[model samples]
Target: MIEKIGFPLVLFAMLAIVLVETNIMTSGIIITIGLNLALALVLTQILALLYGFSKSLKILNKTRRHPLYSPAREASVNAQLRSLKK
Candidate 1:
């Protein structure tokens, strides 16, 4: 939920800053157009990269492992196994 809204908000803020900077510098039409295109390409690539990273993060958050449990949990489970062996 947070990621859905936050990413675009941040992108727009950054693009606004770049536009303001370019306008302040009085960039010519060709230069401004080129800059905008480059910015678009870079932002698209960044968004794609961020999406992949977030998806992997979501997957990682959902996974569970007994080895990752606390030492106390591991010890209890090990003791149970040893008793069963006997």
Candidate 2:
């Protein structure tokens, strides 16, 4: 499935900072929260990228021995391997 909310926390924290900066928000606590939040979200994205890369590497390693990935070899015949008719 696709990730519609990829890095949502990071985006929300950034927007919150923008909202707080224009005096539209009166809460002083949000400034500290937003700054820390932005840093945290940045780290989260980095970790997500690392995890995805690692997973892909593992999958590629596991699939390396599959028939489609085997070293090229001449077949006994080049005819169709099977009929596709219904």
Candidate 3:
């Protein structure tokens, strides 16, 4: 997914830079846009991690028959158990 998303992001950034060079954008606007996008990506990643952690915690508190019981969730719970054991 990162590979899929990264190509399009790079393409868009390059396109924006090209537009700026063509006088279609004002000075500092391109850089500001790029910085904002970068910050958004960073925050998105943080938010995803937080969501994953919350989901994992929820799974830990539920029984096996819970609809949200996924293999990945189980794996995360097991990893947490092992870490706690150490």
**Model 1 clashing-pair count:** 0
Query: For each candidate, what TM-score against the reference?
Result: 0.36, 0.52, 0.47
Candidate 3: C-alpha lDDT:
0.77
* Best-to-worst ranking by lDDT: 3, 2, 1
Off by over 4 Å in 1: 1-28, 65-86
Off by over 4 Å in 2: 1-12, 19-27, 66-68, 71-86
Instruction: Give lDDT for model 2.
Output: 0.70
lDDT (C-alpha) at residue 15 in model 1: 64
Judged by whole-model lDDT over C-alpha atoms, candidate 1 comes out at 0.69
Better of 2 and 3 by TM-score: 2
Q: What RMSD, rounded to one decimal, does every model reach?
A: 13.1, 7.8, 8.4
**lDDT of each model, Cα atoms only?**
0.69, 0.70, 0.77
Tens-digit lDDT string for candidate 3 (1-86): 98998988866667766766687774677666864676677798899999999999887677666786788987998899999999
On lDDT, the leading prediction is: 3
